[model samples]
Target: MRQFDRGEIHARLRAVMDRGEPIVMGGAGIGLVAKAAERGGIDILMAYNTGPFRMAGHGSLAGYLAYGDANAMTLELGREILNAVDDTPVVGGIGAADPFRDIGRLIGEMMDLGFSGITNVPTTGLYDGKFRAHIDATKLGYPREIDLIRMCRDRDVFTVAYAFSTDEARAMAEAGADIIGAHVGLTSGGWIGAAATLDIDRACEATQAMLEAARAGRADVLVVAHGGPFEDPESVRSVFERTDVVGYLGASSIERLPVERAVSGVVRDFKALRPRATRTAG
Candidate 1:
């Protein structure tokens, strides 16, 4: 198959949105996402390294350092994983950083590895004080975000920005985000509570607010509703019905299950939802 340029990917996404199909955004650790994408089980894959991973001594610190220094190990590992999946678009990057330089480096590495896009959460307000402090110390403002967006745009790479509110989503869109991802809960720690304890009504309200924010910003930009505590597909579908979100991303729910089982179940569910063809005279 021919490699798709950024314009081609964007056009494909727009066409998918036009059909009102939800882009199944599977979120997992870098390794899992790359593995799933390689199996052709995911439509879009988000490589997110949450805070807990760092606290738990999961090589996140090493990854961060590697990213900062453009370490060959990090770049090679990222490329190797991404290159495993030929069909799925693997959007690479950790969920925590500013993503200006990190994204650029990742994109360069991914391109070398034969991947196309990169994803990250570039918030004006960092969820953690340390993260905020880092950004502030660096003196990188919203303009840096705008510059990142322009850079991605120039490369034809897709950029997904996660915002906590409709206002934030709109601000990100204005700042040049190609995709606006909404955070429906306490996004700092990356844990959105449990499915049983989740307030469905509040989630719906948040989804509506995000949709309104996306509409107010740029109708052309893709909106993705994420952050979980949603109990089931019904709960997810409820938000999907009201929001302009073309995709969903979450780890809490899926991670709650055994990885292999969760992956198989999700793939089965996706297949089950497909319309059966009518039997015509052959």
Candidate 2:
């Protein structure tokens, strides 16, 4: 119900960094998760195209597939997430390369929707091989994401840009991203997560490189690690230890994995309940 300006968001995060605690931006697709995450003192709440799918127990990659309109889904999910938390800064994800909408109008619409800021998601940076080449050739690529970040910056909206490589990181930073999320790969864990891709050590190295690149472009830009081995607190700690990353931006790692574990475990416990006649007296 509350809205935050860019300066206020920066000040809040800066305060967190000064306190020596890693900031956590949690992905929330549903109201309960958003409310709970706010109660847990999350630094940011992110709503994006893939989040609803992930929360629905589907693979997050489904957002990138041709099932539905990605940007429309994000705005819809953003409204739900925004309505849930009282004051947490919610960063709405935009599919920058969506050809159907005017980019500037989309950014304006997100701002008007009570989102505290913006981020790139359902991103082309996740694609590769021939598909990647084709997208790049057609102008529906990472560059459009950078342009989105720049537009947000011009509007004085906070921006957290996700980057899959050092070049991408630097580009986003140069385009005025307030924070750079060094995206290693699809998160690896839980039932629907991607298979273990990079080990912790390797993921740390890659994350460090991307963060460094972001810093190279904008010396004061905040940096965070996301995806790949950064799925759990332990792995995220390693990233903090090895890189200058001050935080983490979690998608599936936040909403899906923990939900999958907790819900299934509780249901299993309920299933294990037996009749009194089948139970032995204590």
Candidate 3:
């Protein structure tokens, strides 16, 4: 396991940012993927709770369902990811809204496990309507995610937090998050992703709004785009052309969609290979 202090992690990311090239962060669920990502020049690897399910041919939404404990699964997956990457900073995505866990202890354990940073996932911000309201009223909500960022800051741990709206982005910046990921919605593409979501224009508008809000809270806070129409380099470039996002955080875009396309295409090609004619034997 490779360990990086908060300063070291920031320095590494800053080096990339200073080079006039955008940073790239990929989500990895397994060691093989993590190793390949690092080798391919990925600046960061996020061991997200949803990553395993996404790579397992299941929907990323499975992380939000009651299938398993999000935080625990993230930690367990983080260990595998940590072992595979040599130096790329790996951030652990924690379910900060969990009511039964001691979040402070969990943060400590993540740091000890060689994770270079932390982030919020399986976040309450993903829910809305009466369900979201109930979560807020129950003291289990986005505020806890903010508190998680604050806790990481207090411990000198780097953070890349997801924010679904301007308010969430502002709050995350105020809480000392190093990177604010402008999450427009569940990523739209791939077999199990959202069927419909914000288009490129709307995604850019939403991302810009959130990044602006984050900057208003903390002028130097880094902003990255995630989810929605950012499923490929071209689409992501559209966002870069339209917004001030410094980079992109790819979950399904990195792990699921490409794998799905590549594997399916290769299998089809193999199936298309016809047997040699019997005349060859003659």
Candidate 4:
């Protein structure tokens, strides 16, 4: 109901985590998760998939020029996702050729749609030599990207940086990332490329390494884990148990379910988890 700042989101998430109740925020497709966050008092985090742009190759760059509007169906899908949530900020464009330009377009769209803050996974875009070299020559840093950090900070936008390695996490924190999330089992292409066999062992290893790096850098970062081939609630819970991650993020698991069924299931689960004090005092 209330508009949230970056600090508010981080503090509320940390408070939730401190109480030993793992904050469960859905990754992408703002439709269901945004509504879940608003009604369930849960935090919401969205990671936009820019893989299509990459897959389309340079010739398809025209689509991006129109802010990807040429694909109205995709935009409509995004709208469907956003429509399900109320007052939940929509983080946009995880991997992009020009992050600043993409972010600007996304922010403008969100603003026009009356959405909240924007967050992203900037470093994940540089998985190749060309992008990596661009970052390096610009003195913006690479693998441990910093340009987006600076841009978001300057704009006072909430940002979440995905770090595949401990060093990447530390560097992002040092670069002024508001939230440093560990992308365990995450591939360069996004959730679509995430392996189904991903397990807690790998999740734990990545989380621990990220925690150590964040602490070593003396950075107060809000850590999150995502990109596992989640099969069920137990598997999802296992990831939380193995790591100090405050929340998890991903869309493939939920997307695989019938949209109606998934939405109803999420609603039921939220209701079941409601605190007893708010449960009609029965």
Candidate 5:
């Protein structure tokens, strides 16, 4: 199958928005989950290297805590994702801050492997206080992400960026991110979620700021949201009502483990009941 470039990605996003439905970008850690998302009619798949962590009964955020070789795991997942789904585009989740990687070479390899787009993960936003200060001092955080997005644009690769703040959104947009995603912590209620840091209204408030900031750099830049209070359909709708965000992204919220929790409970109800004959007289 042919891979989609940035233009095709942007056009597809716009078409979804036109339908008055925010595009859904589901994060799948494995092919089984990815195939499920495709059948559900989601617009894109965000396959993160951190995905394997989800399979290990951890949140995708644990990917940031450093489980293993992220780049290595992600490249292997990329192969599986392409093999699993067709026509549905996938945005490769990249830890762009890895200093050992050659940005140019990485982009080329990913494109060759049939990735439709790219996004930064295990992001700098996860750091705080002294660790954040240290990351800044070492120039190994958002700086690397900024430069990586530039390289992607130069190579005409599709790009999606995660921004925890308006400033980060602006930088990514100016660097040619096709999609500027406002991240609001982990999705609440997932089996392994970090706590929701903000309520839906508050997250939308923050997302609005990000959208305005990103638009300043590229007026047509597509805006999306992920994590935090935007967990269910109601919460996602609340966000859309309050902000101009065009869509949402899901990690554990879209994958098998969380659904497994729901499914297990439902199936237990039937198992608890005794079988009874419905026919009385013949």
Candidate 6:
């Protein structure tokens, strides 16, 4: 599998960050979406079978549901995405820290499949309080995320760690994540979304906090923001003006959200055309 070392990965990331044109990384559940993102010049493609939840008429949160095997799904889609896109590096959403699976073995398998890097998905980031504690007690929680990224770093495979808080950001950065994505809940305002309760300014503040924590661990940790107020480019730009994040991750934003808007308007336009009562001319 073609792979980018840590230096090359950061160089590519820096090139996009330096240009200020925005680095576009899309999460795709299917081949068509992956192909489309590549055509649009997306810098990276993240594959998680859960992305198909929208195709099944469910929300992106369905990616975290108990239905499918997360690792299995990602590898299945990751390979297909690589085949569909010409050169865009694909990130596999590994279900890190699952006690039922050997994370080390899983990482090796992901590398063998030609993945350019890995990221945590179907993450336990959203859970909190007793539920979160219970997961951690079982040893199948975020520690797995840290270990998984560390393993990848050992091999020099690129890694993007999804952290929901400043503390999590610190742990991930210290664990050697090449890119630390500060995820702020689910992308909202679309069909089947968790309301993005945090205002844009607050989200930016939180992202800055996360960046500060990561930098405290490693000065060069590349930080990106995703979800919530980052559901669109305009929203991201709003936050960008307020924070120092390096980039954004457009899962629902780039894929389902735009498709929903565009397809709705397109169908409406087609339906609006006058009927045969007007006598059509070619």
Stretch of 10 with least lDDT, candidate 1 = 186-195
Q: Write the residue-wise lDDT of candidate 2 on 106-218 in tens digits.
A: 98898999999999987899999999999999999888999999989988999999999999999999999999989989999988789768998899999999988888999
Residue 226 of model 3, lDDT score: 97
lDDT of 6 by residue, 1-282 (tens): 246555676678789877876666889888888889888988888887668786566887777768878788887887777788777788888887565778888878887887888888878886778989999999878887888888888888889899999899999999899888898888887777676458888889999999999999899888888888678778898877888887788888878887888889999999998889775756
Residue-level lDDT of model 4, residues 76-141, one tens digit each, is 435655666665555544333343446456555653543345444334333447865776666544
The candidate scoring highest on TM-score is 2
Model 5 TM-score on a 0 to 1 scale: 0.92
lDDT of 5 by residue, 1-282 (tens): 447887887788778888888788988888888888899998989877778788767767678775687877888998888789988999887777777888678878888889998888767876778998898898888878888888888888888898888899999999999888898876677556766479777888899999999999889888988878777777888888888888888777788445767678889986787656643535
Q: For model 4, where is the 10-residue window of minimal lDDT?
A: 54-63
Q: What TM value does model 4 have?
A: 0.64
Off by over 4 Å in 3: 277-282
RMSD score of candidate 3 (Å): 1.8
Q: What is the C-alpha lDDT of each candidate?
A: 0.56, 0.90, 0.90, 0.54, 0.82, 0.82
Model 3 lDDT at residue 115:
91
Candidate 6 deviant stretches above 4 angstroms:
1-3, 277-282
By summed lDDT, which 10 consecutive residues of candidate 2 come out lowest?
273-282
Q: Listing every candidate in turn, what is its Cα RMSD in Å to the true structure after a full C-alpha superposition?
A: 10.3, 1.9, 1.8, 10.5, 3.6, 2.6
**Least lDDT summed over 10 consecutive residues: which range in candidate 3?**
273-282
What residue runs in model 4 are displaced by over 4 Å at the alpha carbon? 30-33, 36-41, 50-83, 94-96, 99-115, 121-145, 187-198, 229-231, 257-282
Q: Is candidate 3 or candidate 5 better by lDDT?
A: 3
Q: Tell me the lDDT of model 2 at 182.
A: 91
lDDT for 183 (candidate 5): 88
Candidate 1, 1-282: lDDT as tens digits: 124566777877777778877766654444644565446455665554442243233422333333433233334445545555567665554233343446566557656655456555323443446776676577654445555565666776777777666666787676667777676753222222332333667776787687677667776777776664453456678777766567776544333233435657899998777454633425
Error of 1 at 13 (Å): 2.5
